[model samples]
Target chain A: MISSDVIRGYNDTFLLSLLTKGDSYGYDLSRQIRELTDDAYIIKETTMYSAFARLKKNGYITSYPGTVTQGKKRTYYSITENGRNYLKEKRQEWRITKEVVDKLVGGDNK
Target chain B: MNTIREYIEQMFKGVPVTEETVQLKADILGNLEDKYTALKESGASEHEAIVTVIAEFGDIDELLEEFGVSRVNEQVTKNYETMSESDLRQYIQAKGKMGWNIGLGVLACLTGVAGLLLFLAFQSVLSGALYIGLLFLVGFSVIGIGLFIIEGMKAGELERFSSPYIILPGDKEQFISEQKDYKRSFIFSIVAGVSLCIMSITPILVGALTAVLPILVGVAFSLLLIGVGIIFFTYSGNIWSAYESIKHNGKYVEVIEKETVKHKRNKKVDYVIDEIYWPIIVVIYFVFSFTQGTWAWSWIIFILAGALESTIKSLAGSWDKD
Candidate 1:
């Protein structure tokens, strides 16, 4: 389980990383996150879209008209080079943070 | 499962939940259907399988929060969109500047009125310049009205309810920050007003000694400028009072994902000439004109008719639906 404050920042970064691979719709993205977390995490559609809004505003990613198999066209977002760089930076930062916290929490066990 | 769906819908009941949220719900249901399919393959009864899936799904509130939606689903009453952060800053700056202009203009109007009265009292010495002095009075009135009207028009264009720059929308902390900035500027204005009042003492006393009563004369002239400033600042009904007042008026326009604001009160452009201002201007013109015993009724009748026109306009606007 993740603390709510930390979770939001993580979710934003994770979404950016996923988009760096290719375009995906909201539902598919949420399911991918679930599978990645081994069912430990589930993101709501609202959070995903809100992050999408923030990312779009910051110029990290851009959206375009794309059609899915089902209904009307959906606004599919692709990661710009800027988004890819941001994801790389965030990944390094999160790794360092997780490593430091894990040491402190596991000091006695170690 | 139906109970869970009902619960989720009930939770989102009054919020302006966008179409995206509805589609998201359908996705969640699809996931639930998948879970139900897996449970049925294990040979459990259909109702029990549904219950198991519902139990596994946990709370939707946490899911909603993950998407940055407000959990405490109160209807957002003031939906003022279009007033972006930069626009808001511009509005505040414009209002402060308008206040300064009104204050200074009022001081000028007072000087003009006092100069006319004093010049008239010593009419024997400056008889040649009296017409020039009358010209100043008319000129001041025209300038005052012109500035007031322009400011009112600016105020009208300001977006009423939504502020775009505030990233974490509806945060009380941001609200407090805005209020503090407003209060600080408002106090600064009051201090400036005191200094202005002091500046008017010399001309006011000099005019009274020459014959026109000082306090009554001073107050009348002062209010004209103040009224003009208020109109200038509150011109578009975009001031702090406007924000509060419009809430009492309810959003006048329907809006969607992109924010839009509706004017609650009358949108009539009343030129910022209040009752107090007209009476004062008329009396000053009347005093100086009657002192000269020229045809003064024209000024008086004109002021009276203008006042009647504004009053009728205001009353007629009330006929709009509640």
Candidate 2:
């Protein structure tokens, strides 16, 4: 499993990407993130909610009262245009950071 | 479900109650409830599901920090403990007893007045009536004051639990429902008191008119009727207020809707009338006695005022909720 400290920087990116997939709620988004990471990661509930708060605060994501299922009222989140743009920038940032770190440590691994 | 709800409530406890914080709690509760339900459906036991859901909730401090709610603001939370179910029940019972004692004390004092009046009212019919009246006054007043002292001691014991606790998280629904259950009985007690107070005057007035009893005898019994009615009503009112005070405790108020908090606080102020109602009733008693020359009829107004006030508190608190 990926350590929370290692993945902390990209929490917003993963959430925004899921929002871009479709309007989704916190629990579902967290589940999707875990499955998509193939069990290597599971977003903390606080981390997910905090990211949602930050994204909504920054206008990167918008939320609304969504459907109730099994007696629970869910707040669904969808990515805004600004959120997609931010997600794109994060993707680029991750690629370059991955490249640099890999090059720096790649030789030691071999 | 309650575990999930309490996890969310505790996570946000000690923080200020604001729209943002409330929404934050709602959001967390919604997500956690969904997750817990899904986990349960997947063959996980309740304990296992709750553990998983809470584990994923991560550190409460993290969310608190994210929202910039620092440890310094936690003093309010530290001041209150979550009141358990048994504790609430016990406190309510104690409050009930205290209320009954206080009401009974008042009744005793009133009955003493009636006992004293009985001798004076029938002095023509009996010898040494005035002296017996004085004795009656001293004796019943002693009993009434004794009851007051005992009830006061009970209240002193209760003072420790009064302001320092709030409702336990999951108990909120049960609290509201129990309050609702008490509603019917409370109204019944109020009405019963009213009936008793009315009975205090009616029988003697009718008996005197029929020459079955002296008109003066009615005065003594009127006070007795009023006293018993006050006790009955006061008992239920006290229990109802205990539930109310518990509901409005600062910890319980944290997660309540913003309007509910407002209504509850308003109810607190609204109840200051409890202190002044007797004075108002006394004033009304005098006005009725002087204006209409009917002391017998006017005194029952105390019971009427009591019932009216309790009904208002009961209805207005709920009215604001709606």
What TM-score quantifies how close candidate 1 is to the native fold?
A: 0.42
DockQ of candidate 2 is: 0.42
For residues B1-322, write the lDDT of model 1, one tens digit per residue. 5665674566565433444455556555555555566668879887888776665555555655544444332334233232223444565566555655554554556556655654555566666667876887777767766666676676556544322211223322343466556665555554554444444454445545665555444434443443344333332323454334223332212332223222222443232344454666668776776687432123335436656866865665566434
lDDT by residue (B1-322, candidate 2, tens digit) is: 8877876776676765544556778878877887888888989999999998888888777776666444333654454454566667788899998889989898889888888887887898799999999899989899999998988777887764555354544465677789999999999998898788778878577657777666656767777888898898779989998888777652453543333446546647465765676677778787878799676667657657867977877776677668
Chain B structural similarity (TM-score) per candidate: 0.42, 0.63
TM-score of each model, paired residue for residue: 0.42, 0.50
TM-score for chain A as predicted in candidate 1: 0.87
Residue-wise C-alpha lDDT for candidate 2, range A1-110, written one tens digit per residue: 77899888889898888777789988888889878889789788888877887888799999888876777677888899999999999999989999998999786876
Query: How high is the TM-score of chain A in each model?
Result: 0.87, 0.93
Q: Write the per-residue lDDT of candidate 1 for residues A39-94, one digit (tens) a residue.
A: 77767544666677678767888877566444434566788888888889999999
RMSD of 1: 12.6
